[model samples]
Target: MFTNEQVDRFHKDGFLVVPHFLSQATSQRLLKISHEYLEQIDLSNHPLTRFTTSDKDHLGDEYFLNSSDNISFFFEPDAFADVDGHHKLVKPKERAINKFGHGLHLCDANFAAVTSGNADVSEIAKGLGFQRPRALQSMVLCKQPEIGGAVPPHQDSVFLYTDPLSAIGFWIPLEDATRENGCLSFAPGSHHDHPVTKRFVRRFDKETGEQLDGTEFISLENREQIEKGFAKEENQKWVSVECKAGDLVLIHGSVLHKSEVNSSNKSRFAYAFHLIEDTAVYDKLNWLQSSVKSILY
Candidate 1:
């Protein structure tokens, strides 16, 4: 549970880091289970969906779009090597995966134990004034050594939008996070300054009323003005958030945050999930739609 001072800091700065949120043993257990899951994946016929934060390279294949209720793997953009004009995984599949996600908390008992119906997490959600917080998504981000791609600065509300825009991210590192290993960096208080002016939505064909193949970031504001605003935000200062294993970082929905590419020899693995207020209207056009039962805590 968060203290009054911690909650105040989170509201003011748009993020808060709580040290030792989980025991080191618990963190390691999750990491071990994740690795086991990765080892079981047979990537021979995989669609090779590469996850990227860029709108141009955004993934919207069936594997990704349908992963809302199933655990699916995504490779890092740089995890492939060009060989004879074909792409080949540079490392083993277990090491090449950037993440496996979207439904771990709902489908995996190990992840569910830590994410849903947990006293501490529920208390923290209540402390943040969430009347009906739903854990909608969960993932284990594997920032593999040297190949982990950089995540561009963006707002979480864009990806997980609601009418009132109530989305919060819970990030916990299973290994030590540092500047060299792609630790997250945030523009403090950016949530207050940068409103949710765009949404990453699934496109649909007007005639057929069927979902399109890919995704797009539709502008909530004037297209020209939103582009200008985003250009200006590129120069904003960001503070790196470095922490040890088991530390929890709460990120505000609209905060501008990003991480650099992993250039270190060591890998950085982390577990993360997003929570949204069930009272708010979750946009139907949002790329992710839950197929499982609602997990309210």
Candidate 2:
């Protein structure tokens, strides 16, 4: 079940990790599915792409949602039986790394790249200690501890299809996840207050001189306070959950969290499933869906 300390930490940090949510068998099953899925598509090159691979700048890859994994995940039978309820899997648009791409892509960048697919909800919910059955949007993150495997320090709520404020995540580690590889980090209690929104203008890279379009120029969140080194002051206030295979972390979706990079030569991988409210609406921010159909090819 959920512990008091875990709950407290979740509230403060926007995320929490349960030591054991998935059995070794379950994690293996999902990973197996991923290996098969990876065979059919062009997904390995994108560091941070919507397709696959870790390509961070392939923001256009966000719309690439044509995987058997996604369809199966959104409508899986177990999905209908959860406490918070089941959520859908939609591909997301990656945030702009440069200046020309200003419009918000309708799909969210929930790291759809790594999630293998929708989970076996009944089994997953039961494993997470939810008695009555629950559904959630979960993704499995697989990382190999090579250099540059670190995820950037962006917040999850900022990476979404909509502005929903409450979500409890189940972060499961299929292998022994350590801080040296890429684990997760969070800003405690960030959920209760006003959202920390970052603003920026896309600019050319200083060294590469590549133009960055539609990027944040500044932030309206508690800029001064967040920068004040509260992390160093409150040891407990800043916690990064690490785990072994079968271990899981339940987190508040609104928590400001980011994935650490795997800087080692060894292989490190974990799958994370994202769950949101059952009733959340995923409106398409891309209005030109019909307009550009025939013109561009």
Candidate 3:
């Protein structure tokens, strides 16, 4: 459970950085397992799934799906103390662009759509003031590259459209995330009120042919212009979440947030888990007319 002050901050700011959520030992152990899993799946260089055009360009024909699927990295010493699945749990990454420029080097996806982590997320959501709980959605995000792999600024809500206003996220940096390596920057309290926009188009890397279209990315310069276009009240309140390994940031469903481009020689990795409302039966508010009218009248 979170303190009143902590929960208050989440409502007011649309985000909160919880420090040291994972113990050092757990962090090290999880890191090791991630590596082992990569090897077992033969994802040595982390050749993940990329989106090609259509059926004609199906990314994986030679790469067969590991029949022994649903493997767990959370076995025993697994970092996540809890479990559940359903929404999405992805390990996303990006490398570099080849000579063709279109030959987008490394953009891949691995181990996704998980139902675990509900217990963990439910508790967090209640602390933030959600009365009823339901299993919402969760996912992992990774973008580690030198150049030509900048993720455009965007919001998750626009992408994974779901229910109830309780959707919130937990973003963890698997590695030390910094401005140099593209940590996330957010427009504070944008969630409380903001204009909804069209889902932006996605791009694809040349080499992998993985489509980069996501509610999570957009062009940098375009982002700047969009931010500037906001009212002065909105611009002054923007906040960038730059965390080190082991830190976690909680974000609201409607928050306006995005990451910077990785210009560093090293790699960048981060994981995000979100919950809508967990298991709580909201019979009255299940419908807009009933829920709203019931409350208002």
Clashes of 3: 28
The order of the candidates by TM-score, greatest first, is 1, 3, 2
Per-model lDDT: 0.88, 0.42, 0.46
Report the C-alpha displacement of residue 168, candidate 3, in angstroms.
Answer: 0.8
Best by lDDT: 1
TM-score on alpha carbons, each prediction: 0.94, 0.54, 0.57
lDDT of 3 by residue, 1-297 (tens): 457888888888878888876555644554454444444543354233342222233232212121012221111011112336532223222132110101001111221211233344445665766665433323234454554244444455544343333456777676777888878887887766553343222344648866433212323334455554454433545566778776778877777777666778665655555445543333311111011110100
Off by over 4 Å in 3: 41-120, 131-137, 195-237, 278-297
Per-residue lDDT of 1-297 in model 2, one digit per residue for the tens? 555665566566666666656667766765565444334334334333222222234233223332212422111111122355644222221111111111111122323322222344333433434433212233435454343244544444444323343334556666677787767776666555535454322344668766544232345456677555433323334456667876766655555566665666544445554443434542333111111111000
Judged by lDDT relative to the true structure, which candidate is superior, 1 or 3?
A: 1
Candidate 1: misplaced stretches above 4 Å?
Answer: 206-209, 221-231
- For model 2, where is the 10-residue window of minimal lDDT? 288-297
Model 1: worst 10 consecutive residues (lDDT sum): 223-232
Error of 2 at 268 (Å): 2.3
